[model samples]
Target: MIQPIFVYGQHILEQPCTDIQLESPQLQNLVNNLWDTMRNAQGCGLSAPQIGLPYNVFVIDSQNAFQAIGKGFRKRYFDAEDKGIQGIFINPQLLEVSSKMWKAEEGCLSLPSLIKGVSRPWQIKISYYNEQLEYRIQEFSGLTARMILHELDHTNGILLINHMGLLIKKYLYFKLKSIKKGRVKVSYPISTR
Candidate 1:
């Protein structure tokens, strides 16, 4: 089922998520919901907190992101096809990230209609439990790494707005307020209350 994403001003999105019990019913449900909700909203990633669960879990399908961006990066980051096994990282740890960074405009399902330039490490090493509850350690670069990092931030109670520069933030102030006030429009379901 596609659950409504918690928007800005929602307490749940700001609260840090806790580690999920491996192979548990709650874990499975959250995984399913994250996948469904992310695909439904056309998002590259989704975290448990985005859908009201404060558990350490997030899903990433950077292939879609890569496809949208075009041919140049298709093979550089991930398999653009065979979409059956997307990254469903549970109890994920960002053990390493390169000092070299890439700045890109980032957005969130929660904060719809908002995108800001945020600099992130170009490469990363992470460990997590897969969909089958198997332990895995993987390294990623380019869009895949960026997607994972963005979702990981959600589990840590960090939003894209937090990474914006002063000028960008100042420019977005009233627009953000409009979102918080329910005056802005969003395609996906969001709970701002």
Candidate 2:
């Protein structure tokens, strides 16, 4: 199912999610929903919280972003059998985010019709349980890393708005207000509650 994104001003976006059992049928459904919602929105990632589930789970498929990484993206990450490196990451814990920072204009399904400049680490190291309950530690860079960091923030109840300074927030006040009031037009479905 293509689940609706829980937009800004929603309490779920502010409340940290809890980890769940690895083998639950509901967890499988949530993962499927995340993938579907992300693809429908043309987004590189989606978190459980974004779909109104307070579970520490997120799905990332930045490898699908052919333009961002060029046409050879699959070649870079795919194996001989064409199995690409991307999927649901559960119970994610940020092991480290590099001190080096990169600034970019980021858009979120949670903050539709809006794009904000935010600074994030250029690289990250994280540990998490995969959908198969396999514990893994991984490092990533480029937009892949940025997307993971962004989705990881969702699991911790942190919004991209929280990363902005007061001045920027003030500058975007009207746009943000429009979103909260459900007046902004978004291509994808969103829930402000």
Question: Which candidate achieves the best lDDT against the true structure?
Answer: 1
| Local accuracy by lDDT, each model | 0.83, 0.82
Ten contiguous residues with the weakest lDDT in model 2: 76-85
lDDT of 2 by residue, 1-193 (tens): 9988888888889998898788777988989999999999888889998999999999988656633554565454323343334778999888988988878778888888677777888778999998788999988776677788899889999988998889988999888888887787767888877
lDDT of 2 at 78: 28
Q: Count the clashes in each prediction.
A: 0, 0
Candidate of highest TM-score: 1
User: Which portions of model 1 miss their true places by more than 4 Å?
Assistant: 73-85
Give per-residue CA lDDT, model 1, range 100-186, as digits (tens).
887877888889888777788888899998888999998878777888899999999999888878888898889888877777676
